[model samples]
Target: MSQHAEQAAAFVLHSRPYRETSLLVDLFTLEHGRISVVARGARRSGSARRFTLQPFQALHVSWAGRHELKNLSQAEVPQVMAPLVGKALLCGLYANELLQRLLQPADPHPRLYLYYTYLIQELQQSADLEGALRTFERQLLENLGYGIGFSHCHPGCYYQYDTQQGMIEVTADRGCYTGTDLLAIAEDRYETVDVRRAAKRLMREALAPLLGVKPLKSRELFIKTRRTA
Candidate 1:
Protein backbone atom coordinates (compact mmCIF):
# COMPACT_ATOMS: atom_id res chain seq x y z
CA MET A 1 0.00 0.00 0.00
CA SER A 2 1.14 3.53 -0.64
CA GLN A 3 2.15 5.63 2.37
CA HIS A 4 -0.75 8.08 2.05
CA ALA A 5 -4.03 8.84 0.36
CA GLU A 6 -6.71 11.53 0.79
CA GLN A 7 -10.50 11.40 0.62
CA ALA A 8 -10.74 7.79 -0.46
CA ALA A 9 -14.12 6.05 -0.52
CA ALA A 10 -14.22 3.75 2.50
CA PHE A 11 -16.41 2.06 5.09
CA VAL A 12 -15.52 1.23 8.69
CA LEU A 13 -15.40 -2.56 8.92
CA HIS A 14 -14.48 -2.64 12.59
CA SER A 15 -13.14 -0.43 15.38
CA ARG A 16 -11.81 -0.68 18.93
CA PRO A 17 -10.59 1.73 21.59
CA TYR A 18 -6.87 2.54 21.41
CA ARG A 19 -4.89 3.83 24.39
CA GLU A 20 -6.62 6.60 26.35
CA THR A 21 -8.04 8.78 23.60
CA SER A 22 -7.80 7.11 20.23
CA LEU A 23 -9.32 4.29 18.22
CA LEU A 24 -7.82 1.50 16.16
CA VAL A 25 -10.12 1.27 13.16
CA ASP A 26 -10.30 -1.22 10.34
CA LEU A 27 -11.46 0.20 7.02
CA PHE A 28 -12.42 -1.38 3.69
CA THR A 29 -11.28 1.07 1.06
CA LEU A 30 -11.87 0.84 -2.66
CA GLU A 31 -8.15 1.23 -3.42
CA HIS A 32 -6.93 -0.70 -0.37
CA GLY A 33 -8.68 -3.99 0.28
CA ARG A 34 -8.39 -3.95 4.05
CA ILE A 35 -6.37 -1.70 6.40
CA SER A 36 -6.00 -0.58 9.98
CA VAL A 37 -5.59 3.07 10.99
CA VAL A 38 -5.08 4.86 14.23
CA ALA A 39 -7.79 7.40 14.83
CA ARG A 40 -5.87 9.74 17.05
CA GLY A 41 -7.97 11.45 19.72
CA ALA A 42 -11.20 10.29 18.17
CA ARG A 43 -12.13 8.87 21.57
CA ARG A 44 -12.18 12.36 23.10
CA SER A 45 -15.70 13.43 24.01
CA GLY A 46 -15.71 16.51 21.81
CA SER A 47 -14.14 14.97 18.71
CA ALA A 48 -16.40 15.43 15.72
CA ARG A 49 -15.25 12.13 14.23
CA ARG A 50 -16.20 10.06 17.24
CA PHE A 51 -19.63 9.33 15.81
CA THR A 52 -18.48 9.58 12.20
CA LEU A 53 -16.29 6.49 12.58
CA GLN A 54 -18.91 3.76 12.69
CA PRO A 55 -19.98 0.70 10.76
CA PHE A 56 -22.76 0.75 8.10
CA GLN A 57 -22.02 4.36 7.14
CA ALA A 58 -20.38 5.76 4.00
CA LEU A 59 -17.26 7.82 4.45
CA HIS A 60 -14.45 9.58 2.64
CA VAL A 61 -11.30 8.90 4.66
CA SER A 62 -7.78 10.32 4.56
CA TRP A 63 -4.83 8.57 6.12
CA ALA A 64 -1.05 8.90 6.16
CA GLY A 65 1.96 7.11 7.66
CA ARG A 66 4.71 4.82 6.45
CA HIS A 67 3.67 1.80 8.49
CA GLU A 68 1.06 -0.89 7.95
CA LEU A 69 -1.12 0.81 10.57
CA LYS A 70 -1.66 4.27 9.17
CA ASN A 71 -2.74 7.41 11.00
CA LEU A 72 -6.26 8.60 10.16
CA SER A 73 -5.85 12.23 9.14
CA GLN A 74 -9.44 12.93 8.16
CA ALA A 75 -12.83 11.17 7.84
CA GLU A 76 -16.37 12.26 7.05
CA VAL A 77 -19.52 10.21 6.53
CA PRO A 78 -21.41 12.00 3.77
CA GLN A 79 -24.07 9.34 3.14
CA VAL A 80 -25.67 8.93 6.53
CA MET A 81 -28.69 6.74 6.03
CA ALA A 82 -30.81 5.06 8.69
CA PRO A 83 -28.69 2.98 11.04
CA LEU A 84 -29.01 -0.80 10.78
CA VAL A 85 -30.86 -2.39 13.71
CA GLY A 86 -31.88 -5.85 14.97
CA LYS A 87 -30.95 -8.80 12.75
CA ALA A 88 -29.70 -6.44 10.06
CA LEU A 89 -27.02 -5.12 12.41
CA LEU A 90 -25.91 -8.63 13.31
CA CYS A 91 -25.65 -9.52 9.65
CA GLY A 92 -23.52 -6.45 9.05
CA LEU A 93 -21.14 -7.50 11.84
CA TYR A 94 -20.86 -10.98 10.36
CA ALA A 95 -19.88 -9.55 6.97
CA ASN A 96 -17.35 -7.23 8.59
CA GLU A 97 -15.72 -10.11 10.45
CA LEU A 98 -15.51 -12.18 7.28
CA LEU A 99 -13.78 -9.42 5.29
CA GLN A 100 -11.41 -8.56 8.14
CA ARG A 101 -10.42 -12.19 8.44
CA LEU A 102 -10.31 -13.30 4.80
CA LEU A 103 -9.20 -10.29 2.78
CA GLN A 104 -5.46 -9.78 2.26
CA PRO A 105 -4.08 -6.47 3.38
CA ALA A 106 -3.51 -3.88 0.64
CA ASP A 107 -4.81 -6.22 -2.03
CA PRO A 108 -7.21 -4.28 -4.21
CA HIS A 109 -10.51 -6.03 -4.96
CA PRO A 110 -12.65 -3.40 -6.65
CA ARG A 111 -15.36 -5.87 -7.58
CA LEU A 112 -15.60 -7.39 -4.11
CA TYR A 113 -15.80 -3.88 -2.69
CA LEU A 114 -18.87 -3.18 -4.75
CA TYR A 115 -20.45 -6.48 -3.74
CA TYR A 116 -19.81 -5.67 -0.09
CA THR A 117 -21.25 -2.18 -0.39
CA TYR A 118 -24.34 -3.54 -2.08
CA LEU A 119 -24.84 -6.25 0.49
CA ILE A 120 -24.52 -3.84 3.38
CA GLN A 121 -26.93 -1.41 1.80
CA GLU A 122 -29.37 -4.16 0.91
CA LEU A 123 -29.37 -5.53 4.45
CA GLN A 124 -31.13 -2.35 5.55
CA GLN A 125 -34.22 -3.33 3.58
CA SER A 126 -33.63 -6.96 2.73
CA ALA A 127 -36.46 -9.39 3.43
CA ASP A 128 -34.30 -12.34 2.46
CA LEU A 129 -31.33 -11.78 4.75
CA GLU A 130 -29.92 -15.29 4.63
CA GLY A 131 -29.94 -15.31 0.85
CA ALA A 132 -28.16 -11.98 0.75
CA LEU A 133 -25.42 -13.21 3.08
CA ARG A 134 -24.96 -16.39 1.07
CA THR A 135 -24.67 -14.38 -2.14
CA PHE A 136 -22.02 -12.15 -0.58
CA GLU A 137 -20.16 -15.15 0.75
CA ARG A 138 -20.07 -16.60 -2.74
CA GLN A 139 -18.84 -13.31 -4.11
CA LEU A 140 -16.15 -13.02 -1.46
CA LEU A 141 -14.90 -16.56 -2.04
CA GLU A 142 -14.91 -16.07 -5.78
CA ASN A 143 -13.07 -12.77 -5.44
CA LEU A 144 -10.38 -14.51 -3.36
CA GLY A 145 -9.95 -17.24 -6.03
CA TYR A 146 -11.39 -19.96 -3.77
CA GLY A 147 -14.79 -20.21 -5.40
CA ILE A 148 -16.35 -23.69 -5.73
CA GLY A 149 -16.51 -24.63 -9.37
CA PHE A 150 -19.62 -26.20 -10.86
CA SER A 151 -18.44 -26.63 -14.42
CA HIS A 152 -18.28 -30.42 -14.19
CA CYS A 153 -21.71 -30.70 -12.55
CA HIS A 154 -24.53 -32.19 -14.59
CA PRO A 155 -28.27 -32.64 -14.23
CA GLY A 156 -29.68 -35.73 -12.45
CA CYS A 157 -26.28 -36.44 -10.83
CA TYR A 158 -25.01 -36.09 -7.26
CA TYR A 159 -21.97 -34.17 -6.08
CA GLN A 160 -19.71 -33.39 -3.17
CA TYR A 161 -17.23 -30.61 -2.54
CA ASP A 162 -13.52 -31.23 -2.10
CA THR A 163 -11.47 -28.33 -0.84
CA GLN A 164 -8.57 -29.14 -3.15
CA GLN A 165 -10.51 -30.03 -6.35
CA GLY A 166 -13.79 -28.20 -5.89
CA MET A 167 -17.13 -29.81 -6.84
CA ILE A 168 -16.80 -33.50 -7.66
CA GLU A 169 -19.36 -35.90 -9.05
CA VAL A 170 -20.47 -38.77 -6.83
CA THR A 171 -23.01 -41.53 -6.63
CA ALA A 172 -26.43 -40.56 -5.34
CA ASP A 173 -26.09 -42.51 -2.09
CA ARG A 174 -22.72 -40.97 -1.23
CA GLY A 175 -23.32 -37.42 -2.30
CA CYS A 176 -23.87 -34.50 0.06
CA TYR A 177 -25.42 -32.20 -2.56
CA THR A 178 -28.09 -33.17 -5.04
CA GLY A 179 -27.68 -32.26 -8.71
CA THR A 180 -30.81 -30.16 -8.59
CA ASP A 181 -29.49 -28.16 -5.62
CA LEU A 182 -26.14 -27.73 -7.32
CA LEU A 183 -27.88 -26.54 -10.44
CA ALA A 184 -29.95 -24.10 -8.44
CA ILE A 185 -26.86 -22.77 -6.70
CA ALA A 186 -24.96 -22.46 -9.96
CA GLU A 187 -27.73 -20.27 -11.23
CA ASP A 188 -28.14 -18.45 -7.87
CA ARG A 189 -31.70 -19.69 -7.66
CA TYR A 190 -33.01 -20.56 -4.20
CA GLU A 191 -36.65 -21.08 -5.00
CA THR A 192 -37.12 -23.98 -2.60
CA VAL A 193 -36.24 -24.85 0.99
CA ASP A 194 -33.85 -27.57 -0.10
CA VAL A 195 -31.91 -25.18 -2.30
CA ARG A 196 -31.66 -22.61 0.46
CA ARG A 197 -30.47 -25.22 2.93
CA ALA A 198 -27.93 -26.56 0.47
CA ALA A 199 -26.66 -23.09 -0.30
CA LYS A 200 -26.03 -22.43 3.41
CA ARG A 201 -24.14 -25.68 3.87
CA LEU A 202 -22.10 -25.13 0.74
CA MET A 203 -21.10 -21.66 1.88
CA ARG A 204 -20.10 -22.96 5.32
CA GLU A 205 -17.94 -25.66 3.75
CA ALA A 206 -16.27 -23.26 1.32
CA LEU A 207 -15.52 -20.70 4.03
CA ALA A 208 -14.29 -23.19 6.65
CA PRO A 209 -10.77 -23.74 5.35
CA LEU A 210 -10.26 -20.03 4.83
CA LEU A 211 -11.60 -19.16 8.30
CA GLY A 212 -9.59 -21.87 10.13
CA VAL A 213 -10.31 -23.20 13.66
CA LYS A 214 -11.30 -20.04 15.43
CA PRO A 215 -15.08 -19.54 15.22
CA LEU A 216 -16.54 -16.20 14.18
CA LYS A 217 -17.96 -14.32 17.17
CA SER A 218 -20.54 -12.60 15.04
CA ARG A 219 -22.01 -15.94 14.03
CA GLU A 220 -22.15 -17.05 17.63
CA LEU A 221 -23.87 -13.84 18.61
CA PHE A 222 -26.49 -14.26 15.94
CA ILE A 223 -27.12 -17.89 16.81
CA LYS A 224 -27.44 -17.17 20.50
CA THR A 225 -29.80 -14.32 19.82
CA ARG A 226 -31.94 -16.62 17.72
CA ARG A 227 -32.12 -19.19 20.51
CA THR A 228 -33.30 -16.57 22.97
CA ALA A 229 -35.80 -15.09 20.60
Candidate 2:
Protein backbone atom coordinates (compact mmCIF):
# COMPACT_ATOMS: atom_id res chain seq x y z
CA MET A 1 0.00 0.00 0.00
CA SER A 2 1.44 3.37 -0.99
CA GLN A 3 0.93 6.09 1.56
CA HIS A 4 -0.15 9.49 0.29
CA ALA A 5 1.60 12.75 1.07
CA GLU A 6 0.48 16.33 1.39
CA GLN A 7 2.01 19.76 0.91
CA ALA A 8 2.60 22.25 3.70
CA ALA A 9 3.56 25.84 4.13
CA ALA A 10 6.82 25.84 6.06
CA PHE A 11 10.06 27.55 6.93
CA VAL A 12 13.52 26.04 7.01
CA LEU A 13 14.52 26.00 10.65
CA HIS A 14 17.86 24.34 9.99
CA SER A 15 19.66 22.07 7.52
CA ARG A 16 22.88 20.08 7.32
CA PRO A 17 24.53 17.81 4.84
CA TYR A 18 23.41 14.19 4.95
CA ARG A 19 25.94 11.75 3.56
CA GLU A 20 27.40 12.96 0.24
CA THR A 21 24.67 14.33 -1.95
CA SER A 22 21.67 14.69 0.36
CA LEU A 23 20.65 17.24 2.97
CA LEU A 24 18.77 16.80 6.23
CA VAL A 25 16.30 19.62 6.74
CA ASP A 26 14.47 20.65 9.88
CA LEU A 27 11.33 22.50 8.99
CA PHE A 28 8.61 24.32 10.90
CA THR A 29 5.26 23.89 9.27
CA LEU A 30 1.99 25.69 9.74
CA GLU A 31 0.60 22.35 10.89
CA HIS A 32 3.61 20.46 12.25
CA GLY A 33 5.85 21.55 15.09
CA ARG A 34 9.26 20.57 13.75
CA ILE A 35 9.69 18.04 10.98
CA SER A 36 12.81 16.38 9.60
CA VAL A 37 12.84 15.92 5.85
CA VAL A 38 15.61 14.72 3.58
CA ALA A 39 16.27 16.49 0.32
CA ARG A 40 17.97 13.88 -1.83
CA GLY A 41 20.53 15.27 -4.27
CA ALA A 42 20.02 18.80 -2.97
CA ARG A 43 23.70 19.37 -2.30
CA ARG A 44 24.56 19.37 -5.97
CA SER A 45 25.47 22.83 -7.14
CA GLY A 46 22.69 24.74 -8.90
CA SER A 47 19.97 22.45 -7.55
CA ALA A 48 16.78 24.41 -7.12
CA ARG A 49 15.99 22.44 -3.95
CA ARG A 50 19.33 23.48 -2.50
CA PHE A 51 18.70 27.14 -3.14
CA THR A 52 15.12 27.07 -1.91
CA LEU A 53 15.71 25.51 1.52
CA GLN A 54 17.54 28.37 3.24
CA PRO A 55 16.25 29.56 6.59
CA PHE A 56 13.89 32.49 7.29
CA GLN A 57 12.02 32.08 4.04
CA ALA A 58 8.47 30.77 3.63
CA LEU A 59 8.43 27.55 1.59
CA HIS A 60 5.77 25.37 0.06
CA VAL A 61 6.90 21.80 0.69
CA SER A 62 5.82 18.26 0.02
CA TRP A 63 7.19 15.11 1.55
CA ALA A 64 6.33 11.39 1.78
CA GLY A 65 7.05 8.46 4.08
CA ARG A 66 5.69 7.19 7.36
CA HIS A 67 9.06 7.13 9.08
CA GLU A 68 10.51 9.98 11.12
CA LEU A 69 12.71 11.15 8.27
CA LYS A 70 10.41 11.91 5.35
CA ASN A 71 11.53 12.16 1.72
CA LEU A 72 11.16 15.67 0.41
CA SER A 73 9.63 16.08 -3.02
CA GLN A 74 9.67 19.86 -3.40
CA ALA A 75 10.54 23.14 -1.68
CA GLU A 76 10.17 26.69 -2.90
CA VAL A 77 10.43 30.01 -1.11
CA PRO A 78 7.17 31.94 -1.39
CA GLN A 79 8.19 34.90 0.77
CA VAL A 80 11.78 35.97 1.35
CA MET A 81 13.06 37.90 4.28
CA ALA A 82 15.37 40.83 3.63
CA PRO A 83 19.02 39.96 4.09
CA LEU A 84 19.99 40.04 7.73
CA VAL A 85 23.51 41.35 8.36
CA GLY A 86 25.91 41.25 11.33
CA LYS A 87 24.40 40.35 14.69
CA ALA A 88 20.93 40.01 13.23
CA LEU A 89 22.03 36.99 11.23
CA LEU A 90 23.38 35.28 14.33
CA CYS A 91 20.22 36.17 16.21
CA GLY A 92 18.11 34.55 13.50
CA LEU A 93 20.17 31.40 13.79
CA TYR A 94 19.67 31.42 17.52
CA ALA A 95 15.91 31.55 17.06
CA ASN A 96 16.10 28.57 14.71
CA GLU A 97 18.18 26.64 17.24
CA LEU A 98 15.68 27.30 19.94
CA LEU A 99 12.85 25.95 17.80
CA GLN A 100 14.86 22.93 16.76
CA ARG A 101 15.71 22.08 20.35
CA LEU A 102 12.41 22.75 22.06
CA LEU A 103 9.76 21.63 19.60
CA GLN A 104 8.92 17.99 19.01
CA PRO A 105 8.35 16.50 15.58
CA ALA A 106 4.82 16.04 14.16
CA ASP A 107 3.17 18.13 16.85
CA PRO A 108 1.32 21.03 15.25
CA HIS A 109 1.63 24.62 16.41
CA PRO A 110 0.06 26.99 13.94
CA ARG A 111 0.15 30.01 16.25
CA LEU A 112 3.84 29.56 16.90
CA TYR A 113 4.47 29.60 13.17
CA LEU A 114 2.84 32.99 12.88
CA TYR A 115 4.80 34.27 15.84
CA TYR A 116 8.00 32.98 14.26
CA THR A 117 7.27 34.78 11.00
CA TYR A 118 6.63 37.97 12.93
CA LEU A 119 9.85 37.56 14.87
CA ILE A 120 11.86 37.19 11.68
CA GLN A 121 10.29 40.29 10.24
CA GLU A 122 10.94 42.25 13.42
CA LEU A 123 14.53 41.09 13.59
CA GLN A 124 15.02 42.04 9.98
CA GLN A 125 13.63 45.54 10.49
CA SER A 126 14.40 46.53 14.08
CA ALA A 127 17.39 48.34 15.54
CA ASP A 128 16.58 47.22 19.10
CA LEU A 129 17.82 43.65 19.06
CA GLU A 130 17.24 42.94 22.71
CA GLY A 131 13.65 44.10 22.63
CA ALA A 132 12.86 42.08 19.53
CA LEU A 133 14.41 38.90 20.91
CA ARG A 134 12.80 39.38 24.29
CA THR A 135 9.41 39.69 22.68
CA PHE A 136 9.92 36.55 20.60
CA GLU A 137 11.16 34.59 23.61
CA ARG A 138 8.06 35.52 25.51
CA GLN A 139 5.86 34.31 22.70
CA LEU A 140 7.84 31.11 22.37
CA LEU A 141 7.48 30.36 26.07
CA GLU A 142 3.75 30.92 25.99
CA ASN A 143 3.32 28.68 22.99
CA LEU A 144 5.26 25.90 24.66
CA GLY A 145 2.71 25.86 27.52
CA TYR A 146 5.00 27.50 30.09
CA GLY A 147 3.43 30.92 29.98
CA ILE A 148 4.53 33.43 32.65
CA GLY A 149 2.16 34.93 35.17
CA PHE A 150 2.46 38.70 35.45
CA SER A 151 -0.90 39.62 36.89
CA HIS A 152 -1.54 42.32 39.49
CA CYS A 153 -1.57 41.40 43.18
CA HIS A 154 -2.93 42.83 46.37
CA PRO A 155 -0.80 45.20 48.43
CA GLY A 156 0.49 42.47 50.75
CA CYS A 157 0.05 39.29 48.74
CA TYR A 158 2.89 39.07 46.29
CA TYR A 159 3.19 36.87 43.24
CA GLN A 160 6.54 35.20 43.08
CA TYR A 161 7.62 33.24 40.06
CA ASP A 162 9.10 29.92 41.03
CA THR A 163 10.82 28.03 38.27
CA GLN A 164 9.51 24.77 39.66
CA GLN A 165 6.07 25.91 40.87
CA GLY A 166 5.24 28.61 38.35
CA MET A 167 3.66 31.88 39.55
CA ILE A 168 2.48 31.72 43.14
CA GLU A 169 0.88 34.21 45.45
CA VAL A 170 3.02 34.35 48.56
CA THR A 171 3.57 36.60 51.53
CA ALA A 172 5.60 39.69 50.76
CA ASP A 173 8.40 38.41 53.01
CA ARG A 174 8.59 35.05 51.26
CA GLY A 175 7.99 36.01 47.59
CA CYS A 176 8.56 38.86 45.14
CA TYR A 177 6.15 41.18 43.42
CA THR A 178 5.94 44.45 41.55
CA GLY A 179 2.46 45.90 41.53
CA THR A 180 0.59 44.68 38.46
CA ASP A 181 3.66 43.23 36.80
CA LEU A 182 1.51 40.74 34.98
CA LEU A 183 -0.90 43.43 33.97
CA ALA A 184 1.91 45.48 32.52
CA ILE A 185 3.02 42.48 30.49
CA ALA A 186 -0.49 41.83 29.29
CA GLU A 187 -0.75 45.46 28.24
CA ASP A 188 2.44 45.22 26.23
CA ARG A 189 4.37 47.75 28.32
CA TYR A 190 7.71 46.11 27.76
CA GLU A 191 9.68 49.31 27.27
CA THR A 192 11.74 49.68 30.42
CA VAL A 193 14.86 47.70 31.26
CA ASP A 194 13.21 46.38 34.40
CA VAL A 195 10.28 44.99 32.43
CA ARG A 196 12.49 43.38 29.84
CA ARG A 197 14.77 41.86 32.47
CA ALA A 198 11.79 40.60 34.40
CA ALA A 199 10.34 38.93 31.32
CA LYS A 200 13.70 37.39 30.42
CA ARG A 201 14.20 36.04 33.91
CA LEU A 202 10.70 34.60 34.04
CA MET A 203 11.02 32.90 30.65
CA ARG A 204 14.47 31.51 31.46
CA GLU A 205 13.21 30.16 34.75
CA ALA A 206 10.19 28.51 33.14
CA LEU A 207 12.36 27.06 30.39
CA ALA A 208 14.72 25.60 32.97
CA PRO A 209 12.04 23.21 34.15
CA LEU A 210 11.34 21.94 30.64
CA LEU A 211 14.67 22.19 28.81
CA GLY A 212 16.51 20.45 31.66
CA VAL A 213 20.16 21.39 32.29
CA LYS A 214 21.14 21.73 28.65
CA PRO A 215 22.02 25.33 28.00
CA LEU A 216 21.43 26.96 24.62
CA LYS A 217 24.85 26.92 22.95
CA SER A 218 23.87 29.49 20.35
CA ARG A 219 22.98 32.03 23.05
CA GLU A 220 26.30 31.40 24.79
CA LEU A 221 28.16 31.71 21.51
CA PHE A 222 26.33 34.95 20.77
CA ILE A 223 27.57 36.37 24.05
CA LYS A 224 31.11 34.97 23.96
CA THR A 225 32.14 35.00 20.29
CA ARG A 226 33.21 38.16 18.59
CA ARG A 227 31.72 38.94 15.19
CA THR A 228 34.07 39.17 12.21
CA ALA A 229 33.88 41.88 9.59
Q: In every candidate, how many clashes are there?
A: 0, 2
Model 2 scores a C-alpha lDDT of 0.78
Clashing pairs in 2: 150-182, 151-182
Q: Cα lDDT of all candidates, in order?
A: 0.87, 0.78
Model 1 C-alpha lDDT per residue in residues 79-171, reported as the tens digit of each score: 776788899899999999999999988888989999888888788886678777888899999999998888778879888889999888878
Give the per-residue lDDT of model 2 (tens digit) for 107-179: 8889888878877887788666766776677788888887775554443445777776667787665336554
Span of 10 residues, lowest total lDDT, candidate 1: 1-10
Provide TM-scores for the models.
0.94, 0.87
Off by over 4 Å in 1: 1-6
Error of 2 at 49 (Å): 2.5
Model 2, position 160, has a per-residue lDDT of: 77
